[model samples]
Target: MKLKNGKMRKMMTVSLAATMALGLLAGCSGAKTPVSNQEKVLRIGVLYGGNMDDSYFRQQYTDIYEFDRKNVKIEIVPAINQSDWRYNDGSEPYKEPDYLDGMKKIMTGSNPVDVVVTDVSVLKQLIQENMLKQLDPLVQEDKFDTSDFVPAVIDGIKDLGEGSLYALTPSFSSSALFYNKKLLSDAGVEPPTDKMTWDDVFNLAKRLAKGSGKDRVYGFSFNRYMGNDPFWDMQYTYMAPLQLRMYDEKAETMTVESPQWIKAWDTISNLVKEEVIPNNNNVNYDENWTPISNDMFLSGKVAMMISESYYINEIADANTNAAKIKDYTPVDWDVVTLPTHPEKPDIGGNIYLNNTFAINTNAPNPESAWDYIKFIAGEDWAKLKSRSNSYEMVARKSYIQPRQGLSYNIGAFYNIKPVPPTNPKDDKLKQEKRGLYYVENLGRTYFQEVLDKKKSSTEALKDWSEKGNKMLQEIKLNPKTEFQEDGTPYIPEDNVSAAAGLSSKG
Candidate 1:
């Protein structure tokens, strides 16, 4: 598929959380491979999108399950047309999939689809629609062992089912607060602890950030992928955990003029002004005005950052290439649970489960489907998949370990629980008025105005709310109205402020 410049990169970055497959299947010597009464075809449904093909799906399941051993055949059913449900970030407006009808057709017949696999978002929808069979009865009957699974993964899935087990996932993706041990020690600051509040981290950042231009060290970065678009950066990372509301209950009006919104904007702008966090000013543009580098965290110049498991690969790769590159230092880092809101201290907003599996309620071979689910979510699968350097975290807690010769707080990835899904209302609004999705982008411009000191935080939000309300009205009246910002269209890029002196060149 053809994409505009930078669109491919952005799409990949946005889908990073959803990209990794369960990617594992393991063989056991003493395992009793369950079989159907006859040689029945175990039809497996995958939430399909992007370029993932049926062959890839076959490899993911067939290799591990050893269907031939059980006299079974594998068939892949694409449950949805676009797997955009995987995009949990609000960057794109939610598009409710019509998979419910598709699900009915595939899941309700004498020879119905046996298994369904999907991300947690669609898993919730499947459960609510009664398309999935609760696994509790199967677990009890088979005496399936689940004690080795990560508490967060098992508990989070149960929470989705309101204290029931409707599905099981082999792996999860989550963000953790990683800090440079030496940087904090050298700066005479205490290392950040697990579950630190955003305010706590920001205060420490204020203390640790020091020096001017070239030699300056930043205290914290929300993520290593901070872009030149401050409004998008703030909205995507910093403000997201706060759960700031962008629209009313009906999503037909703006809701950003509240005191809470003003406080959030002020807090973000103040951090930028104080240089406690990396902003556009921290980056260097080349002669042609192209961004060169923004990975200050990797250069050992940023004290702390919030990133997912994929970043570990980047860091390892950077370290291996450090000697070949100029003036680079290998970073000594460890991670802890991501910062939490004071009111919701146990919640981690960055946790995601993308490889969930469940049996169809009307499966032709429920026993065989149960066997497949257990095989994937079992300990052997985690053990094998964990050894790979994939950007996903295995659900079995015991299998998770540090890099071969390294030791760090690996528990940080799964210790904190995920924030509950909040897309039901948003989904309803999107179906009613598709244009309501563009309202948040409008706020980005006003937010940048506050950051640039062109407008007071309160005034900026008030103006933003006025404009947003007007746009929502237009969208409600004419659902096809296009949103046009006053200035240039913002194209978000993957650039962050790097350490000014840590040149990529030798």
Candidate 2:
């Protein structure tokens, strides 16, 4: 991808929570053991993850999962969805029946699935059903040194029980704040600083947003999230930046009604009302152009956006595409650190795991499955993954540097800690078990009311909190709700203003 700086780099590695995976699966793994010509083939199950068409799954399938070995032949079974109920970020709850039923068949069928390359919701549901193997045994037996694995990578795979290790991630995805230099300058607003607070950022956004209706400019927007799991954008980009969460797992309660949470909602509400950040309704994609229009950042209709590094490629291609069309000028943009809270001025936005791998316990070849998971999640694979077009950085620290030279704040991405889950581990399961579809389909209704001006922010959140709590109460009553505790983001500098330094670098 050619950046404004004219440096070409392959970009858009994201598709995670939006990036990791293979050069080809041939020599990426070191676990291939010699086997006779008659060696049995290892069958692997690949599930539906985000952006399947251009995702890490495609890379991993070609590179690591489908990796070839002299003695051991490998066969991959791409998960087939017989039903139309996809995990579009909890958007369709009624479809859960079709989804769960399909997955159960895959794991427990006559020809059972082995290792899986899947999204978080699939892994979470598998773990809840005790359908996955405890990988500690394999890790110990293989003497796999997992110390190199990123802490958050491990945390994301913890099961509801003792939070045991049941899954592992091969790559890491995160968000950074992208700004339009022309918009900022035109508004007479200085470019944002790396350590700027949300309040300060919002003020800049308001100033940069101008015009009326169709030709108007927006202050902020983001890349479309995996529809399967939607609320993350709200949590990671909005609330977590302020050190807030919708639910407090440790307390076994909902935090959606808290003052901080309310303020977070109102802040967004006010932005929508003031037309700084247009509501989702106003962001329309041209059917001919599809995502580009709705992707306001690339549409060049937004001044600032919280986007995964994947855009590092998309934006570049956007310019090329724009030049081919009539009357479209390329977006003049650069990036800075994501906005931080006044109190937690140094943290980065929430980080998400990408290409996370897991094994099904009922598989006939659990050992082989473990081998595949470890190989892809280990160092050898990391080397190739780092260089891929993934927008997300690989988990390996050494691989986490900016591509040779395109002029963007690559450091801004690594500048902070990720926000960890605050709820009880079991509660986390209860939500995922139901697909968080309820939260997405139901909760968002009330939240949208506030955005549409039909209900006050406080009133909307309070109502959702009450209704959401009742749903949780019913979920907790399920026999599978037993489980326990577990774990859980950036920035810096001289008084010269980190934002200023970022602008200079740009």
Candidate 3:
């Protein structure tokens, strides 16, 4: 999440009001000193997904800041976790306020902020609460064209009501299955097919699990917490092929109890119960998912794992700790889209995770803020991000290109077709891999929440279907509004029935 200037100052004003009432004017006044016209600083709040020095985050910040420093008068005050914020200057690191506190600090300030950037979900909350400014008028006056933006990315940022657009998605990612070539070969089984079903994966896991008891190797591992929401992740990756829609379009209700969802959960439960997968205790973040899956694959202790594309590179490139597995020897392993359910071949889509950006409604200078937004969305930014250590596929259709010396391919895959520039070098491998797409995670939250309660699969699905529809209705009933004289819009009471009346159309 990133914050632009205008909203931060507003939050600051609101936060200081009580202090002013209590006669603590000295502190509030000190914090509200205005910046001189000569000092043009853009204060932004950002969520650090990786190390501050990480190439992807580093390059994005460098490019934007460098451009802003020279091309426009600007100061960038970034708010990130203190431990994560790094700079050569001796200044202390920034700290994140709790959600409400942060909102108050930015909303009611005397020296109001200029602009803000963040995620769609956060922006949605602010927009509904009348804490954000609509970018539509600014875009219209500035003639900002969205033609170059990906449709899916744009759709992800729009308010559920279709009338307003609150944020811009700059980049995106989806998860896939990463397997160890040596392990599969040693097990006498071929690599899992792009079209394999969950049952097929389970059978292969049985074949791949090796060793006994204390020395036992398990076939698969995933996080298990009510908060973890494997139900949504697994359903999107596996049941998508079954064409399972949790919410009915015409009826406007959840369909989680559908046969497809039940079947998917039952399959996972069987795997857990049968010991085909390691027990939950074996699934620690350090050992199971993050660097561990990579470690296990490299050491031949695990055959295949479900993870993002970035993890594959991290494992294969490790020199000191994970140099043992034959597959970890760069160029030995490969990636394919997550397997789909057998019945609904077209059901699942790519599960894009991190590639997103949003605007703060409380921003002071949205016009100038767009300059940074446009810069990050350009070809140069995409190329830089793609080449960074955390190599992510660019979201734009025009930015795909072949880079020299890199062994792993970086391109989009939808239903097994490699959508890349027509290069002969890229053709042969296209047939072996497929790409899947998915809706944003928010769309599936209901099923996830229900599943966490240890409810029957059928009950969870039904609950999600009802709750999802209710949420949709709320969004539909509450259309976005222009700013009022007070810089705030009147908020309606929570009305589930009113929200359900909303159409899911754009």
Candidate 4:
């Protein structure tokens, strides 16, 4: 549930602008005095970097919040477009912006930004650089009541700020373990509960799986939209929760051959061999089924799945169109917290904070910026935003309810603590090795061999590690080096500068 900026920010764009305005004039303790005592301008920086046209922002801003604009002005500081805000799906090559570099330029130069509207990734970076003002003092000064905030979100941010608070987010995204009540009841299998381990979930899946051919029911699917590679989908959920990594702490060696990883591979492989989970080859898709109709759980072919809260909207839409699809009816489903590991009970890996707001340490109008952060994070704002279809869960829990007439568990989305930070420096390592994530794709092939019994988990992992180490060494020797299918170095013939004596491929 890492925040997809494009998808999540669309919901917050205008309203977020409004929050900035209302808070701007409400608290002016640090506000600069106007030459005529008539007006003061509040400068806001859209940190995630999308187009922030002034007229459009003002229109939406005024529509959401009412305040005396007679003596105050709202201005959006220009931001260089950071990335493609339109395409969140991984269909295009993503360009990672140097946010620290950009913020350094924006905040230090003339007419610097006073407030920032950003996501958690940038918020963490800003806090690390000590460029953002701590909000704890302001919270106490204003007597801001944070009691209603989703505990996991507040706690996670505090953990990042090293026992202090640096930012506030109004909404977050999370996943839950959704089960088909009808399937479980019909099969006489117990439904899943919060904090179950991988073993517990797989065993439950086994009991619910039945039939063969077109009627075959799998016990579980990692995601409803697992297209061609269900194996990868299943592995990602288990891998993160279990704290598996492709490389060791230093990124110099692969860790796939370790006992922890070997056990994980064995667990997934055993389940696939037992027909409890569906792989790419085994999932049944009818030719007559529409694109959305291919969802296993929606079609009643899977008993359970773990997916984000937005998935509920898809379920609702399917129910609305149930009559249009032949031989298909709406699913009877409810959700619980995503399954946890026995070693890390009650800590789930599927929570994300988005649209977080923070004031710059060098803010020209610190008091006004603080007001905006407090206003948007307040209960009143949460109530207004919760009524929209914009977010999966608002940070304020009192406003996070199940859809109008539904009775399913809404608390499942935020009932567990987030997986605590494994290491403070892991973020840097992740950034450095972002390009090396291709190893996951490479491991997918060997994992399939393990599933087919062509090799044991131990043997498959050994081979994956050997090949992975080769790829790492190749990248280390020549950063631009690309690999051949067998994991040997292959430099393109035209790129002679990066050849580094490796075999050239046309």
- Clashes (N, CA, C under 3 Å) per candidate: 1, 25, 61, 0
Best candidate (score: TM-score): 4
- Return the TM-score for each candidate structure: 0.82, 0.64, 0.53, 0.84
- Superposed by TM-score, candidate 1 places the C-alpha of residue 408 at a distance from the truth, in angstroms, of 0.5
Q: Where in model 3 is the C-alpha error above 4 Å?
A: 1-39, 47-59, 62-97, 104-109, 130-152, 159-164, 185-190, 193-200, 203-218, 223-265, 280-294, 318-331, 339-356, 389-393, 397-506
Per-residue error (Å), model 2, residue 397: 3.7
Best by lDDT: 4
- Per-residue error for 276 in candidate 2, Å, reads 1.7
Candidate 2 RMSD to the real structure: 14.6
Superposed Cα deviation of residue 67, candidate 1 (Å)? 5.2
Candidate 4 lDDT tens digits, 267-335? 888877877877777776777757465687787878898888888887887888888878877888999
**CA-only RMSD, every prediction:** 10.7, 14.6, 16.2, 5.2
Question: lDDT of each prediction vs. the true structure?
Answer: 0.69, 0.60, 0.46, 0.70
lDDT (tens digit, per residue) of candidate 2 on 1-506: 00111111233343321223334344454555435445656766654322234343444443445435444556656565423445455454332223344456777778887876655555566677888788888788878767766554565456333578887777767667888888788889899877678888888888888887677787765443212122334554566546564555532456678788777778877787787776656653444554454466666678887776766877777676885755567778887777777667665555664345778778887766776777767677677667654555777665566663467777666566554433324443543444233543565677677777899878988887776565555444431222211100011122126445554876
Estimate, for each residue in 271-298, the C-alpha lDDT of model 3 and write its tens digit.
Answer: 5555555543343333334333435555
The best-first sequence of candidates by lDDT reads 4, 1, 2, 3
